[model samples]
Target: MSVNSFLGVFAKSPIKPMIQHMDEVNRCAEALKQFFKAVYANDWDAAETARASVVEYEQKADELKRKIRLNLPGGLFMPVERTDLLELVSQQDRIANKAKDISGLMTGRQLQIPEPLTEAFDAYLIRCLDATEKAKETIGEFDDLLETGFKGRERDLVNNFIAELDAIEADTDVLQVQLRQDLRKIETELNPVDVMFLYQIIDWVGDLADLSERVGARFELMLARV
Candidate 1:
């Protein structure tokens, strides 16, 4: 087949919707950061405002997904390098969904972030969002990420982000186990139920980080030529 016969990166396909979806994801990350700040301050009003931003970003992502599935474009430029465009898009969508999930948990739960763990969560969140935002920006510049012959500094950022996230998840796991064991004395007051609930929420937050790391990994796989 001629080189021109292959799919165009900018062609009208699910790629556009994917880009919009990731933008919404990035927005939610920012909203969550602000939400964490508000919660740390114990400012209910600020928290509510930040939560609204999450809702808005969630709605936009939902709308974009709907439009993509309902209105399939005829002339699409998908990744000729990676045939798993649908799978990739779905995985990217999950990152945004998980972000919304974390935000939803914040809104519904009466979470009390421990003073020491607060900094850790903040660091984890910043790293996850940094990885996610980098992935999204790279997507917008799709050509560079999907080249058959081209390769350069992109891998440097992606490699570092992925490595950092792996470490973050490990750190979260260690902190959670240590915290739970140390709280054994107070188990009488809060009981295992309350402790479990708190731990589960923290675990879910780590999952969001995991999803972001997966996004970066997916990009790497898609970029690697067969």
Candidate 2:
């Protein structure tokens, strides 16, 4: 196909909406950083404001997902399978949904990271957010991938991006294990209920990284199929 024709096909494809949805998901994930800052400061009001941003972005992602599902062209030719694109969006949406769930649960409980674990928790959370950011970078490569017909340097670049995402996720896993061990040491000193919820929050935060990895895996599957 001619370059213009290729570009035209991409314009009508779900790629733009997919990128837009990831943008929203990234925003939702980012808002958590601010939310945690407020939580660390014991500032519920600021934390609530940040949580509201997470909710807003998650809602925006949801709307984009709905439109993408409803408007994905059935008869139009696409570089990837329609089902693959749909599955990708579904995976992307889960990251945002998990972000919403994390923030809502923490805010509702006014949960606080124990002072002893605060520093380690911050590191773990940042690494998890790094995974989401890396996922966004990987997804953003789709336009270039399509332009290059999913070959040559562009495909290699995407492979490198996915590799970086995988590394970030691995780092989060290690951090999660250490944080859990640290939390375990102090659990006896804390209220039993709060300790349980703290562990839950740690798991939920880890889920962010896990979900981001799933997004990378989905993209890898798309590349393989091509």
Candidate 3:
């Protein structure tokens, strides 16, 4: 392929790469949901399958990230600052990282969900996914923002999405706290090591929402500079 063709394979405007990264993050969210369901059911086979998909998506996100960095043009002709684009990608990538981290911890040590924490755990994970989905939707508006030059209805629309994303993230934070407190209530009854691993998993799952919120924040910053 010619150089243009090579770049064309993955290329869109720089913002497109950021959208692609967020897409991977969204996929990770789905994979995580499946993984959690399988875990809750004690179906090792399905859990393994879902875990593999999460890891695969995370790897794909990393590859796209590297390709984005390598192919990003270094010229004033770009739509946004290259540094800002890089940082945005990095922030979005963290969502996938946390998804993979949670899955890894689940499958690595065979961490079983505590009986009392099961309901809380499921709710917390779903809320985290909600936060990420909101972030993905926010990134999906980039093309519209570009068309409107980040002004008028598009600006208001994206700002609204960001606000909702923040609200969802705030809810996730409360869930995390409640989940932790629930975990501690049962901590004395479980294996000490298992308790440790469960705590680690819960913390990583919360990080997913945290990263998603940061992704939304980064996009807002991009809007400011646009």
Model 1 scores a TM of 0.72
Candidate 1 per-residue C-alpha lDDT over 1-226 given as tens digits, one digit per residue, 9 for 90 to 100 = 1222212423434455566667777786667888889878877778878888877887776666555554445444544433345556666677767767766676677565666556765766675566567657755545444442334665555556556656655665566566555555455566466567666666666666667667666766765642
Measured with C-alpha atoms, the lDDT of residue 179 in candidate 3 is 90
- How much is the lDDT of residue 46 in candidate 2? 98
TM-scores for every predicted model? 0.72, 0.94, 0.94
Angstrom error of the Cα, residue 139, model 2: value is: 0.5
List clashing residue pairs in candidate 3.
Answer: none
Q: Write down the lDDT that model 1 would get.
A: 0.62
Q: Write the candidate numbers in order of decreasing TM-score.
A: 2, 3, 1
lDDT per residue for candidate 3 within 120-163, as digits (tens), equals 88989899899899999999998788888878999899999999
Q: What is the Å distance of residue 42 in model 2 from its true position?
A: 0.6
Q: After superposition, how far is residue 172 of candidate 3 from its true place, in Å?
A: 0.9
Segments in model 2 whose C-alpha atoms lie over 4 Å from true places: 1-11
Worst 10 residues of 3 by lDDT: 1-10
Best by lDDT: 2
Candidate 2 positional error at 13, Å:
3.9
Reference-based TM-score, model 2: 0.94
